[model samples]
Target: MAELLSNSFPATPTGTRFWAVDKILLTYLAFTTILILGWWSRVEDAGMLFAAHVVGVALVVFEVKRPNRTTWIFRNWYALPFVASCYKEMALLIPAVRQTDADQWLADLDFRLWSVHPTVWLERVQTPALTEFLQIVYTLFVPAVLLIPLLIWRKRRPEEFQYYAFLIALGYLASYVGYLIVPARGPRFLLRNLQHVPLQGMWLFQIMQSTLDRLESAHYDCFPSGHTELTIIAWWASRAISKRLFRVYFTYTPLIIFATVYLRYHYTVDVMAGILLAAILIWSAPALYRKLSREA
Candidate 1:
């Protein structure tokens, strides 16, 4: 999977203008720089962040630099890993600048909405059989998110894949920005002691859950569930490529969504925010994608 994702950025013919991916990345880099600068004192490793931005910009230049005429590479696939790097960095970035998390607010909201702590409430129904199934589903979030798009790239037009890439990338990168604004440790950390029953799955469940825990940082990645956002985005975007693929996304996306809350990785509010985020991107981002593709 790493090898496949590493090679997602195949070199493309250098065009004479920036494509949607390049401009989107430039915009994202500029946004991060401003975020760092705005909270410069809080960010202890501001220099490293600025250095990341510099390298990000250099990648753009390496692809598009031209002495006489501007040459913009249209390799939007690179955005996949470029944005993945952005997500990975948030582990360090979120805690450096943000003093506290917003888990309480989210937890309180869930209580107000439903009059109970969602994860604690979920314990009544928690069983090893169900836990195992949901844990496996929860672990599949990345694979499900990546597979639909890769399928599109293999089966659909380049333009279609690029647009989908922009949306998927935007979904994740935007969620990271959401984390910057609102850091949360989710129900797992915040509500660990309240629950009496541990969600011990039968087989692959515990291993998968433990592995994701080891792999994930940015412990406060709960306010807006990237799992929920990108899964829906992948499902919706797949409609353009193939119904079979769309159906695949449709079936598993909700399961992925359920796993977010069921596995204690997100608050109900986080899931709602993710759904809203996905809706906004689906409704409004197509115009932005088209504009960026045409202008840059």
Candidate 2:
């Protein structure tokens, strides 16, 4: 059974198409489409979606034609996020299993941690130069999303990539569970006591807010930040590949994460919890995977 499940989704041989979909490629195409369509109106986001599809198709074609499995793997880092998303959703649903008071968890934390601004100093450094640098650093997380696949392609390290992906999924799942078990309406949603600070990026904030508003469940799970978890997993995975350049690049992910609070999106406690969550996930991932692998 373990061997069968392990082979269920072999992340190799670009020529071998699983279910005629090329599992990783199909996931990328599906997620990109879902994000674009779910964000803007169908017609409005169509052009960008089409172009993205074209590029994705081209990349998959190149990967599939490439003689090596390594080239095929990195071309599809987009698949990892989908896996994480599933776990996050699972986390949200977990509280219901025990009939716990999720709202109380959210409210209590609001009074305990987010009430004071520990890193208020960061907001003061919001000069054009600093903001520009932070913005660059913040955007670095985007590329980290692609790093795992690149590592897989470069080193043919699919096992490591799979392990990293599993860790990310579990981290997100734990975070969402934290959300349910300790639902906090993030700092942005609870601005009554907070000092009003400019986020600078109104458009970006609105887009993100709208998405959260549209979510069907667990709106108050703002503690143990998802962005932080994602960045942490990416950074750790980057380090695993021994790519010093990307390891350094991923190191900056936490700074941008701090910027999330100064940008007035998350609270100081949320950021701290996120960092802590990353540590826990990093520590637990290998052991957990080993257990799961055995059970498989």
Could you estimate the TM-score for every candidate? Answer: 0.89, 0.57
Candidate 2 accuracy as TM-score:
0.57
Would you list the clashing residue pairs of candidate 2?
Answer: 2-296, 70-153, 74-149, 106-183
Candidate 1 clash pair list: 18-296, 184-220
Model 2 agreement with the true structure over 13-58: per-residue lDDT tens digits = 6443332223433554565455445444423435654575667666
lDDT at 280, model 2: 82
RMSD (Cα, Å) of model 1: 3.4
lDDT of candidate 1 over 218-257, digit per residue (tens): 4678869998888888788778767888888888888888
| Candidate 1 total steric clashes | 2
lDDT of each: 0.80, 0.55
Clashes of each: 2, 4
